[model samples]
Target chain A: MSDEAIKKENLSEEVNIREAGGGGWLYSDVVKDHFFNPRNFMRYGEEEKFEFNAMGRVGSPACGDEMVLWLKIEPETEKIKECRWRTFGCGSAIASTSVLSEMITEKDGMKIEDALKIKPQDIIARLGGLPDRKIHCSVLGDKALQAAINDYFRKTGKHERVLTAGAKVIDSVLNITDKDIEEAVLEGAKTIEDLQKKLKIGALGKDSLPAAEELLKFYLEKYFKS
Target chain B: MLPKPKKIREIYFDHAATAYTDERVVKAMLPYYSKTYGNPSSLHRAGREANAAVNDSRRKIAQILHALPENIIFVGGGTASDNLAIYGMARAHEQRGKHIITIPIEHHAILHPLEDLEKQGWKITKVKVNEEGFVSPEEIYKSIRPDTVLISVMYTNNEIGVIEPIADIGRVILKYRKEHNTPYPYFHTDACQAAGYLSLDVEKLHVDFLTLNGSKIYGPKGIGALYIRRGIKIKPMILGGGQERNLNAGTENVPGIVGLAKALEIAQNEKEKENKKMRKLSLYLWKKIQEKIQNIKLNGPEIGDDRLSSNLNITFMDIEGESLLLYLDEYGIMCSTGSACTSESLEPSHVLRALGMPYEYAHGSLRFSLGRRNTKQDVDYLMKYLPVIVEQLREMSPVRMEKQKHARYK
Candidate 1:
């Protein structure tokens, strides 16, 4: 190779994790550390070891990633005693969940309410920020945690404590609602592209198209007379 | 301190992405960069020397392809060659026709240009590939319209390594040309991935245009070649000092051309030996992978078919491809995933989708393109860790069919 080409080949091999975002930022040291050695991740055959009370799942294989979070709460203090997760996703997703698990369990434990306050941005901030395209990977774990929290509240007969406050933020990003999908399907926006053109589903929230399509399928089954 | 972790060997299995520049090719290119560096357009002795090197390299490449040296036009890379071939031919012959035909599985280099032409009042016919990743000649023949001016197909797919029936398709185009007594529709093949192993005789393939890049065949990057049949008309895309017979306008990349020629010479000379080695390694890896992993689907043409000798693409059910890629990268085994997450837009590979692969399986696909440098030990090393990684990722996957149960970490 030319000297320059050899130099480039060496440089490429040494490069740390890079943001999938086009900006070409290198992933943070913390992110790399967690990605290279994720913590509190459940492994094969270890599924029954934790004996967790509630679990939350988010994302989907069709969407290219998914995360499952298992939480154990202390009844008296209502503090999260343990948090374990398994995410089938890119490095950002795995690292975000690993960091989030450590953050929630540190200094005794985060209270259930406080844990619910954790946002996708908080996980990203702890990891020194993820690529723009990968921020949604981080969101999966938090959403799964929220679902698990809701599951916990519903099982404990504390329905009033179930927090569904972040629905609006997600809806705006997705740029479509259940009613919009129902209306579009009813109006014969049958294909994904037709629905996309009608609703502009992927204009901002590129990662949200799959979820919208899944929701559209449900709505179609419910409302489509045929 | 904890015992130092055992150092993992880095094994690259993504040659289809790009090959490592061979040292011999580099050595051949080094002197031209500085010692003999001069603009080929200059009238000085240094310029003559550089010009001579360029001519020699062109002659060498032409010799291998069984084409006249004058027909070779050197450009920047494979994309440039494709753009020049498609856009140049389409615009130059616009008066005669404004229609193009290509397969759905063509590289973006060909497809994007066709789409651009569509905006300029060109009709495009995208033929579909079969499940085995074969584009039928009959399908192309059926799609041919009187106004169709160009047909571009890739010699082999970069992702799945399935070889297209370029020769058969060429015969189809030739038949039309003879019957209609007009050269309205010209055949173009992006032979970028086929240069290392496949036959490149333009007459045998019956192609009016062919594209080959330096980067994919262990040569330096930033250089490519287009073979335009002697009588074919093409318009220049970039306007500047006339170069490459006024088709491509740029000062010759002398060193890059030298490297490309050297790379191609070595590859063609050792093609049979290297092909045998890669085929054996690829089959071994595929067999081992099948024996180890469950619910895995091999993508592309089956072994012993007319597939690239160095590629093995597989999809693991219930596991995300990118996750598995990361895990493998952790162990210093480099490969690629067809998952949408790796792409800008979160959609699976269009080639896989064209082959009628489901979205879920396409999202879980991985490509392992072996090279001559790879050994059985490298495949063994990959096999050792791959099954474990797949099993673990499956357990973590939401779409995994296994029953859900409580899992705890200590």
Candidate 2:
């Protein structure tokens, strides 16, 4: 928020702009464009060869907003590849993933470690800047990358498991439970919109992994065991 | 590079959180900050003079509330006042009963402490509010129990502009005592939001223990008065210099106390005129925004509502309040989303949520509170700048850009 945007021209007519989302000098044409209509966001189906897979998953059962990020890296070389992400966040979080994917795609064979070092400000800087309050949003982006990297190692078995199985990360990422959603939905929900609207998405199933319904059913049946 | 006008270009509308220190209050505190910089407890002449200043301020505040000078205690701020009232009274009177009743909409100043008490083995019954965020006296009456030792409610809501019926609710508690054999509930109110707008006669409101903060009422911060109503006995919350008749302890804030008194005097003096003016301005802004902006929802009561006159909460659909706040800040237009505490959370507002404001509207709501300093011109300028920013941001918004465009064309 620039100090200048809120000039009170007069009392009888203070411009009551809808208090909206994250912004700053980081809010430039690039950020706006990404936020307005993010490019390269949709997945191209399983046919697109994925080289690098980074998914940051964060959730909190209490606060009630769980966010997950899935990034598909199309590696042109041993280190470099293309990246695309699907995220569940406000416009900034989605725009962040799209912008981050775009930024990582620019460099070829880039080490994943360096890609991880990419600050949220660097991403916001790409746009123009984010507001002071929204700067926290930038941190959430970095967190998503960290979580995705951990997930990458988990799938590849390249590093020791950073997260305990089924344990929740407090702030960095939310652990979405297929079981929780299924039960909440099965309790009364009739449609996808009804399910999503009634409950927060704790987790989404990976395209390569078992379906969400299957995983939830498995958990439900296990819990229902005599 | 331009010379200043006869008046500044400052347009202040964020009075709900706190008001800028008034010039008169500043003048009243100058001597205490510099010349009279002596601890009220010291034996020296400077100290005694400082002590005199503290007593004078305390006396003035007590006069305003129609309380005895000895009964008033100067505390840190409203939060401490509320905590002391609820926790202090409950702790001493635990033998009286273990049950307590309070509304859900109280500023955490009172609610949080009660919540803490529940953890410490007290039976707590929380009353609910209606869609307007107003807690009903009927609900309070129904929720009261045999063991209930205290009943706490806020005089005015902090986030939304709903005014609680303190008098009516007080009557209910009074009725409960007359009908049943329950000792009267030590009625407490966090009046942090109502000091400048409503008429606060403790006798009429019938609050046993009331909390008020000077900072929120256009005086200095860290200074507020807690009215303990002559005979209400409670254990002290703070312990030190044993100041404030041992009800509160610490060296008296001589300067802050003086400023608080002067500020309260001015606020009480100007309440009617200022309230009337703010009533007109809030109506003006609310009407104009409804007409000019499309898909916008008003969060609190209508303009003619008996609630706080300075408050105007509006929801711009398909937008997030945080982003809109940033854009408004860019234009030097300051406002708030929810309470100051909710700024960090992605959740919109507890008050709005309690009022049944949906996610779509709550997420995009903005709080534009008016004050004595604001004039019609300031609001008019806001009307001019606000639409452009909304149009621009809405154009860039993924959720509502298309819809906003359609509405704009229509």
Candidate 3:
């Protein structure tokens, strides 16, 4: 949400803070439109209707957000034939992923590479904008799409493409692994600072920091059984 | 040819947040704002009229609370009254004692000030409430110290609506004061939520100070009163002109004061009948929701005099609260949630946490506070859609998936 959107929503008397999911003018009009009426949402018990070639799942419902994206790819054009998603999150998360789904499979379809290239900023632009706190929600949509594209590549025996793309790569200098992240978390490295202090995370590149943080959270969630 | 239909009438269940200003109250205030507008400090006829209105409101509220008119000091809403009572009393009596005692379930208005005092080298002790959301007077008594200068507890909790044993706690405070021959520890109760449904006779409750707000009782916002027992001294929070007997220093809010008095009068007059009707509606809605929905848990005490007649907080398992709130909003129903996502701080209700509720339940809790305007028909409308909303959100929950996975392993 921009300053102008905030001012506009505040100026409007009809916007109920409770009705906006307690976001209180934190969402853009576009975001609200997509959230209240999400396009290509995989409704409950309807996943069986779509024969998708790839599936991606991320986040945990216990932490109050999760997304599952299923994509059907056209083999002839190597484009996404359809994209549908199921999400359990706030309005921003729903809207970001909703627009992402629509953007990817609109008209004929977006190519696999083009869909993978779509970033959180692209989703935010399409949805007008999200609040600063809700920018994290936009990241979920892009991450899920990456996972879906990875799934598609692996399923089609395109092993080289799968390996070359956004697969979780081990940090060259820190040598951070899923197991290493789990061990650090169990050894009381629960925060990003703790990871950096104990395991020297980001010793190699800043790109590995997000991956380490993600794995740390994943393992922490598992450790706490949440 | 047929015409399209209009939308259903919206139902508001967030009365605990703030009620619609009564039309009667508004009518009474209009003259003060336009015709009788005057600074009470001015020595003109208009000023006299405004001062008379303020005095009349003070007398009206004092009579309702069974307190002397002179002891009623008007200020800005509940938060202001709370600040005046806690910060004023604590600062005034700090020389006698630097310790304060309160419950963990108190509103932030009380809790946050005590915390600030603690930072300034005051000892603060917090008594915990039980899982049923009741604070035992004995627990507060146990926490009381010789240096404890104030004990501020809310009369009725705004979120859970559990009525604390305030009079009993007051008796304990009075007994301790009498035995010690010291007025070091003064008892206060924030009765903003209780002003409508509960008796607030200061003498009967044995409280040194009591806080009441107008907005929660269909009165105008930005006006409230604190009942200060005669002969009790407290420092003023605001410093300026000698208004509000020098306790609250500002030009009087004549319109708001008049509106508050009228609103309180109407609330007191109709409290009994309103409570009876609302209690029945609340219980009916509770039973209907329980019967219609699975995995539902009530968050507050059992419905009765002990609980506010209008408050019903419940949690739905396997679903988050924000989603339920949004869905209900689309259906023209308004309510609040205890979920962290719903709050600016991203922290769930401290009252629920004090009750020892699990994180999942705390994250899923929804608060429905009924009011004088609500009816069984409105509740019927709620029930018609709530079950479906809960079911849809539950189906989308990942917790359900985890449960299925666990069952498969079994």
Candidate 4:
């Protein structure tokens, strides 16, 4: 149709623009799939896998939006391998979960602490930007992801493992030489709680724990260096 | 995708947040986006032509409200109009009295400024709403004193769909001022959520300031007008090329303004019919949700004509609002919790809490606000999915199921 004809038609009706997809802040396909057919919507584990459940089980019935995240983790890597969520939310949410699932799949073995850094904006950016109001749906994704991670660590006896990762711990409580700590880690001093107990207390000052340099270096690499 | 169960249209129940641009509003706004495109501020014929369109829209908006064209200051949307009203009042009337009184139920546009005003040393008093979500006239009267410069009570509660009596409350302030005969308490009502549900006239309502939003009335967003009664001295919130009487300074959103005016016209024109249709739907949805789903409570108003036509805020016990929403999303039913602004908060709704709703039940509330575009079929579809979805989600919730089991046994 010519411009004049389009103008005439628009004048006769409403100003409906048929723009090609991939224009907004969110990927239309990702949003569509998530909204239309949300994946991992329900938890499929036995009672043992769940660490803790803080369902958003109360509040406004008007939205009819609910999110449930059932989580499981690898004890060795402290990585989140499985997450099942049910969102009574909008398309943006469905897309957010899909994107979140993709991220989880890619980082299958990356530590949970690293996964915690993923924000709603990252999910939206994966698609594009979302409509302004739909930003909350993205935030819900972020919340579900965190809830699952928190659930995983809390369920098993590895709640203390969060500090063992790329974390900055000023160690004066327990002291070990860098080489000894490295040797122990290689020899499977796995959880830092075990490492602390194994190394024993009073062997070092708070700032004198094995290679404070490395902890600071890791922190710098992840955040401060940028 | 489950063998593609055919294509389905999403249910839109978040109209209180915004309405999809009505087809009529779109038709009205089309000229500015194309052939009739001209800067209203220009000196040339094109500019003059644009200026006429702007004036025409302004006049149409004025006609709907029975206000003078000069009173309608069109800006981006509800938020902008609100800021213009509250900020303009605070700055312009700084010397008059440094205090302002508004209700707890006011939108953030009003609440945020009142907060800002507090930082600026203005004593801001938030009037409390009762368990029924009604802000009393007595509270307004008690809050207003010698220093209370401006009194802003909304014409309606946005979240819970409670309509406030502006005339009754505004009269109290007027009576209070008759004795003092000096300090005129500027009254502003953010009627964005109530545009389609109520008849807004600055004169008959006797409000000093009133806000109209396009999106709420099915006009395009990013455009609305604030009616500041003549001789109401308020400073400009947005400063630019002296557009909007040098009060709001940005070059106007012409298409938005046009669209808004037409939307308002259509809303006013069709208010009675829309109200009847929506009241029936709201009442029906409310009844159906309760009959079909167990442990549901109607939060704002008992099912009646009193509630906002499109608002259906239902509270389901032991149900998480967001989870139910997700379950319903599978069936393509789109809705919102009360106030899209703070959906991610872990706390209960401020509006519902103020309404004396218990935190447990308040947190479980879901606002299924309806719109002009929604129909009986949509409600029927919602009715079909709601009970099943709620039951499914609740069963998945071990605690909820256990609680129900405990209750049933008891």
Question: Judged by DockQ, which candidate is best?
Answer: 1
Question: Could you tell which candidate, 1 or 2, scores higher by TM-score?
Answer: 1
TM-score for candidate 2 (chain B): 0.92
Q: Which digits, one per residue and each the tens of the lDDT, describe model 1 over residues B208-264?
A: 999999989999999999999998989999989998999988899999999999999
TM-score for candidate 3, please give it: 0.82
> After best superposition, candidate 3 residue B197: deviation in angstroms?
0.7
RMSD of 4: 12.2
**What TM-score results for chain B in every one of the models?**
0.96, 0.92, 0.95, 0.93
Off by over 4 Å in 2: A1-98, A101-226, B1-10, B339-342, B400-410
What tens digits encode model 2's per-residue C-alpha lDDT throughout B304-347?
A: 55578989888776555655665565456788775221354444
> Which candidate leads in TM-score?
1
Cα lDDT tens digits for candidate 3, B161-221 = 9999999999988888788898758889999999878888888888889998989999999
Model 1 residue pairs with clashes? A47-B407, A50-B408
What are the per-residue Cα lDDT tens digits for candidate 4 across B1-410?
Answer: 23222556688888887778888778878889888788899999888888998999999988878889998998888888899899998888888789899888788889888898798788988888876677888889888878777999888777788888888887888888887896578789888887877888777787888998888888897887899888888898677899989988877788888888888888888889988888888878877776788776677766565568788787666556655665566567777664322354333477876776554456466888788778888888777667776665454432342334324221
Give the docking tier of candidate 2.
incorrect
Worst 10 residues of 2 chain B by lDDT: B1-10
Those runs of model 1 whose alpha carbons end farther than 4 Å from true positions after fitting are A1-26, A166-226, B1-5, B401-410
Task: Write down the worst ten-residue block by lDDT for model 4 chain A.
Answer: A11-20
TM-score of each predicted structure versus truth: 0.85, 0.71, 0.82, 0.68
